[model samples]
Target: MNIQNIEPKYEILLDTICKTYETGKIKAFNAVNTELVQTYWEIGKYIVEFEQNGAKKAEYGKALLEQLSRDLSIKYGKGFSRSNLFQIRAFYTKFPKIQTVSGKLSWSHIVELIKVSDDTEREFYEKQAVIENWSVRELKRQKDSGLFLRLGVGKDKKEVLTLAKSGQIIDKPKDILKNPYIFEFLKIPEPYHIAETQLESLLCDNLQSFLLELGRGFTFVGRQYKITLNNIHYKVDLVFYHRILRCFVLIDLKINEVRHQDIGQMNMYLGYFANEENIEGDNPPIGIILSKEKDELLVEYATYGMNSQLFVQQYQFYLPNKDELREEIESVLRGDNEIII
Candidate 1:
């Protein structure tokens, strides 16, 4: 048979093969996600029941898990380790309510949530992970890097807890700001050379993780979103619509340290969105400047008395040492002590 004469038949076969491959891939992905999530839910149920039934037996839960692990590993195989069982127990304790676990997050994400000691912080990260569709690795890095503590440190405990349990309920503008945004998902080195364009590109490439770090309800609208004021064109680094907040989230990325001018620019962006794009029933647009560093005094002065909603937050390309972040939190708490002479 001449090769050229067979070309049409070969092309049809190739197209069918590609279609079948894609269908199989989709089915496999769904199967794996469903299996992992269901397993975690069952583990949570067992742990909760074990604790309730055997409260008088000091080592009952541990012994039960050990025997169950051995039996399950022998019969079914992988992911039945003693440590994983402990994680499942912790998962139940952390999120007792089934409704709290969103379908988008897998058991792997829940495993990362087990490491968070603070219940409020754990809930916040979990909700954000599901809402933003964060990968398990991204979830782990964000939790380990102290993202929640950094955001919730100065906030009222009750209000912060409410946000964690429910989700971003932005009754006030300040509620939308996370003081120090974690960007370890980009896998960039800290204190390394990088430009604004590079940062913007990395964020857009990993926009899902960026949204997770930003918190819940953020939907990516565009990058370098263009706007014009009086014939002058300006581009916002990233644009998002926050479903829960019912407003646009205009993010401006800065490579160098933040300045008053950055805040002014963000305020202008917010004003434009409010006046030009805001619709009925929509709240005022929120502006955030994500920079390498920020001066607290400068941010206070720049945002003070300005009605337009604006925030200045620092972003770290690398995960800081966990101990270092904890120590810093302790130092800040101590500094807040009002010393009586």
Candidate 2:
């Protein structure tokens, strides 16, 4: 049978058959995964109800779980171990309302989510994971890096509460900003010194994790993205298109504190992108200066009159020092700044 002798119509038919098979396979896989998640959730619910006797009990719960674990392991094999049972029980307790549980997520995803004690924070992660189609590893990375906490910090109590109820909503350019963007996925040691180029390289190597940290709707465009004006050349460290916001996002990385010049250069980048690259359908571009530190007063004064959306944010190579970050957030919210004459 010569392949060249095959009719075009038959070739098209063959392609369609393959596509249909793949679609069916995916649907079957999803259905199986959904049922597995539901079964685990039901088991979790049963364990919780059995342990509840009247109120939450520590010692009684421990004994009950151990006994149940032993009995279930004997009958069902490995999945019903004491640790697994504890995870399941915690899962049911965390999501008391079964309706809130997502069948789209696997047991591994739920295991990661169950560790999040805050209802609001857990809800945010749950919604984001489904919306973003995060893998278990991505979900774990986000949680370990404190994505929710970083977004919640600096916000008022009410705003922070809102974050738990609804995942970060990007209504405006400012709404998309998170201070001290965590880059823990890069695996950079806390004490290590790395240049801007090295940072960009690490980020590109872990692009998926980087985008997830950046939040929803971010699609990478390019690195060292060029802009030319008056025969002078300038390059953005990284560029991304935000599908939701319908705008270009330009990022500049700095190993040290941000300065007035950094803000000015970013403002220029935004202007160039707005005038040169932005088409009729695109929103004005936004710029972010990601540095290790920022002078609050300098950033405030430098960006005061800018029409473009410009933000100076810090980036941590490792997980943030939570207490220090919290203190800084408090100071910013308090509007405390020192004047330098």
Candidate 3:
């Protein structure tokens, strides 16, 4: 035991043992987590059942939870606070059929989903969470950014329903689009007027968060992806490959309102990528012009005759107005406006 010199195979043996130990720990933790979630669901179910059988349902509402919280805390120790119990109860109420609940999501993720009052919106996030394995924090950010609305607004009603039921499916170029892409994670400074190059650099610095905001199936190709046509050179601000769509996505950043010339520039980039960059099995490239401001009329005309698949969207430095967006979505659902994309 005291020998200073170790055998050649000793390190390998120790490494294998360490890996096995870590793997076992992870498996055990997951098993415990699953059981814990199931137990919470049962508790919620029992609470609801008890209230139904009570003489006065109102008596079993607040008072029942308060007494249960005190008793559970005293007997089982922490994690049974009134707020936590409320969440547990709501979890059951929201998802009565335990079979429908996702086994992939953690309790924290479920808590965040429970806060989403809209049934369709909550279902979208739940399915997306299970499919994408989004962390609790990521789920919160997406909800705050009004991802459901972004995907559903101005989109076909049936497609929106499918998206809600099955998370996001990238069947076509527009499936990956998010209007007014949120970049609050970049944390731009006081003046809030960052140059295009500066914005690109900040995006790189926060690449992970940026990719999450970008949605599913995007892999970074390169920054300042260059293309040369007839001795003149141009750079796309960001280049990403969509694994699902099997296409190249080129994005350009603009600090000012997007001009018609900017739209033409992105079309050129897409043309270059489609003809010159695409491989034998690759699909046509898609271009996105992300600007600080855009005129719907201007963009409509700028992209009117373009052959290459191009999109003009806004990029805000901060989170969007969630309440306003939510109201818009509610209005749409109520048949106030039937806008199509």
Highest-scoring model, lDDT: 3
Per-model TM-score versus the true fold: 0.67, 0.88, 0.93
lDDT of 2: 0.83
What are the clashing pairs of model 2?
A: none
Which residues of candidate 2, in runs, are more than 4 Å off?
A: 1-4, 54-57, 322-341
* Ranked candidates, highest TM-score first: 3, 2, 1
What is the lDDT of every predicted structure here? Answer: 0.76, 0.83, 0.87
Let me know the TM-score candidate 2 reaches against the reference structure: 0.88
Q: How does model 3 score by TM-score? A: 0.93
On residues 131-195, what C-alpha lDDT tens digit does candidate 1 reach at each position? 55677876776677776666655655455566577655555667667657778778886457888
Off by over 4 Å in 3: 1-12, 55-59, 189-191, 338-341
- Best candidate, TM-score-wise? 3
Candidate 3, 1-341: lDDT as tens digits: 73336577777888899999999998898888888889999999999888888866665688999999999999989999999999999999999988888778788988999999989899999999888889899999899888888777676567778889999988888888897799988877666966789889999999999999999999999999878889998888999999999999999988889899999888888888888889998999988888888999999998898854799888887778877877777776676776557
Per-structure clash totals for the candidates: 0, 0, 0
- Model 2: lowest-lDDT 10 consecutive positions: 331-340
Instruction: Give one digit per residue, the lDDT tens place, for model 2 in 127-206.
Output: 87887788998888877777777887767756766776767778789878887698877878757688889988999999
